[model samples]
Target: MGDDHWLDLDTSKYPFPNTLWHIKPPKEIAIKVTVMLIVGIIGIILNSIILHILIKNRWLWSPSNYLIGNLALVDLITLLLCPWFMLVRDFYQQYVLKHFGCYFEGFLQASLLLTSVGAVMLVSYDRLAAAGLTPDARVTKSAAIKLIVITWIASMLLSLPWITHREYVERQWADYLETFCAEDPKVLGIYWHFTLFILVWIPLGLMVVTYGAIMWRLEWSAKKLSSKGAGMAVSKAKTSAMRIAACVLITAVICRIPYTVLIYWRNRLSNEVNSVEGSFDAMWFAANYLIYMNCAVNPLIYGFTNRRFRKAMDRTPGIAWCKFGSWCCVYPVYKRKRILEVDKNTEKVFVIEGTPRPNRKLAHVIKNILHINKETLDFSVKIDEVTTKPTKITPLKI
Candidate 1:
């Protein structure tokens, strides 16, 4: 097992020593790359919209929503940066970005993912407090900002191994150079296990406990309401809350658990196992797809599931236009008339006819008419009549 021993082997008959350099079938590559590109692009778009909505709406600037906004931000960055490297790796059958890319990509993905997990956990706890089960757990705006900052810092520090342990190694094959990003295998094992604990297990456990407590409290409240003959209303509310909680928990497990299992399985196998074998490769692609899908699905789960978020989304300008089209259009002008009695003593009726105008302009018009009348007597004015006449206008064609 000398450094050059691989060189002595017949290149035509032997495969590369590292599975990272093994190319998959072109068809497989095309399908996987295309699928990833779609998911990544969709995730980027969805997260961007979510982030924009959060930033634009002043009313949505609550502590819990700040955590949600942070989640969208993390998902946006992850979808934007990490996926390109992954797609490249998938297509090239090796780490093509060389040394700097190895460290940067790994660190970026790890930090963003951990940050997302932390935000989701915070959101769950925030919801628990909002449910009034743990009123003390409610956070102020300042405290929420602090928590976000701490989460990011912790994520980066925890992911520091990605920067330190990565090595971009190149080996000269018989006719071509084979390059792959290597990590300290022992460190990788420990790091991934730790990552799984933080990303999957801890969050999952917290969600179960947090949502469980909220549900229990809701059930108790429903029971109390049952005595008051409002049980049906409370029951419906409880069911809706349970449905949302179930969706959140189920999505987390579906998106994350497969990837965690894949990592665990890989780590359990011997180092020499071919990672690009058909079954394992398919599993890898499927697992990663689900992970990215999670990023896109977050806005739908957390945003649409929320009554306030749904209201805000409906109120968003362009969104209403998109949804209802011509129905959102407003009449720019309306034909209006007002009849006023200048004086009860004189029985003089003054009529004003015009399109609806601002109060100042209408007042100026009235002053002009009064000045023309040349009546200097102390006069009492009264709004004798007000009416709107419909005017025909062409409908805007979409």
Candidate 2:
């Protein structure tokens, strides 16, 4: 299109008011900044505790845990750095004019952003493996550690270009500073294709396929176990996995889908599109941030849906009060012995108290199958006599 024709074309095609910069007044900006700061701090603290549990509890180290740890580290960095942007957006909307502020904001934004994309990709694969596991399957610790390293490295490399190419320019009509994050035609063309394939489409697409298979498998198990008198455990697992898979699907749709579509269009219409005059930046920020928040939200899914994470979070004091819905009521289990005397018609039976729900169910099933129900009683009646005879029982007060 010629310049005259382009000028004649209505600019309203670019919809929505552009209020991303100085949209809110100073006071409002402060409030926004403060809220973001507080949330970021809490996220960092909670993610740190998650990392600690995954590390200290050797038994919990698995491929899924490694993905979660990498995500937490990404969130930690984002939270730590976002407050500076919050301050600038609040107190110094025009601070992009300052060279230091410009580079800092641009670099951190790119880091948090590209890292987030990579982290989500890793999480998608991790969840795929985790969800694909057989009822008794688990991803090994060595594999998990290796994947975690790969996730960090991939994310770092993806974000490196932004750090290297970011520069500041002047825009006469707009704010004094124009922060142009490097969008090199050739380089970005390659990156767009590469990221779209590996990070955007492949990982998310695999998640959809993997989770579908997992749900199908879990549903099949539930159906099979229904007639086997397996109680609620199988059903509960199936239900939990289904919900988590749904959440992941929703997250991918809301976060990745739009960006992917926009990027495809942007690539096709490269020079044809001069500038984004609409609410693109705002929507982009919202979508991207929501995706980044998924890292924090995963811990919540674990806390609510996965019993082990809930128990660990309860014991982890620093993160217990974050109100991310990961809190649980936990009673400390202790080992103890009781002195007892046995009599005829009574057998030796031990009750393992304070066991988790899954273990409790399994233990009860095993005990019932073995026909061993005794409270420190003597087996003097007869050989293989499965009889329930209650004798005098007194509580030993603690």
Candidate 3:
């Protein structure tokens, strides 16, 4: 807050030299903060469940699943780290954005945001590959891993400008908090703007074209599938794929457009022919929340669009919230959650009959579960009654 010791809302740099910006009323600020708390918490829970399901089922580890897992990982990190700090800053009326918090938020945000968008794009591309657009007609597991590694590296590079320009300083206007996280606008502003363009616009364009092409291909393929049984299977897969693509595309656009537009609007405010100062603050508040809201809804998209995902979620969160009536009851079990396996010949049969021992830890539980990634395996835990056994036993890979 060297500029004025105000809460840093721009998410670009903190403690800027400009202290002339409008201030929000306490009531309005409180409302926005409340929404953030709710969304951030929900996002964390849902994304974690998604990650658990992805991790538990070893047979599910394909190229598509890898992208899905990467996505959940990024979103989980963002929901956990970014929103918590912002909520604290807003709720407490703190003028100081601590140095580490200020610098790290933008750094992590930029990297995670890029990784999220890149992942969605990867999923779209993989669908195209699966639909016979490429010679292999599938993304090899090795190639998918390489692509994921490349994405994280690229995000780190893209977000480098923020790290280099950040600073810790005393707030000029407020003495309540001695130091705040600030950015050196002169050093990083231009690069931030350029990278912002590449981050927001490039993905918007790609998603639009990629999803459109996928729809067209779906239509073309539907005609070639003439036999009823094979045609039905093709139809189901295509329909499910397109539904997911559409939902992801829509959620990303809806959440990102406002924030991107508002940032653009503020940057262009001086060039405006009319007075638009008052609404800018409100719009900025709304736009930022929109972005936050985007982080929260991927779980909803997955649950609604994919039946297997829905089933997997049902095995954890659904079981926790619906059957047990409280997440606290589900937490201990999910924390030590193990694999669920069924034999190829039998249906609805679980491999084990007792709950995981709380004292016995296994490093390979998540590893084996993820590697054995089968979506259709019955995860319904049924224990032998009147015996010293619990229903939810962690299964070893068969």
Best by TM-score: 1
Clashes of each: 0, 4, 16
Which sections of candidate 2 miss by over 4 Å? Answer: 1-24, 31-35, 55-59, 82-138, 169-182, 189-199, 227-232, 261-278, 302-304, 317-398
- In what order do the candidates fall by TM-score, top score first? 1, 3, 2
- Overall local distance difference test of candidate 2: 0.57
Residue 21 of candidate 3: its Cα lDDT? 27
Return the TM-score for candidate 2, rounded to 2 decimals. Answer: 0.62
- Candidates in order, TM-scores: namely 0.74, 0.62, 0.66
lDDT of 2 by residue, 1-398 (tens): 01224334444444422344444466756765665655666667667777766666665565666767777777777767765564554343333435555456655665565666566666665565555565445556686677667766666666666555544533332333223223455565576677666646775777778788888877787788888777367787777688778887786676567767666655554333424423554444454455455555655543344455555555555555663333232221211112122333455354434333544587777865444334334333433234567533333433
Error of 2 at 62 (Å): 4.3
Best by lDDT: 1
RMSD of model 1, in Å?
13.1
Clashes, model 1: 0
Give the poorly placed runs of model 1, Cα more than 4 Å off.
1-26, 273-276, 324-398
**In candidate 2, residue 315 scores what lDDT?**
55
In candidate 3, position 292 carries an lDDT of: 65
In order of lDDT, best first, we have 1, 3, 2
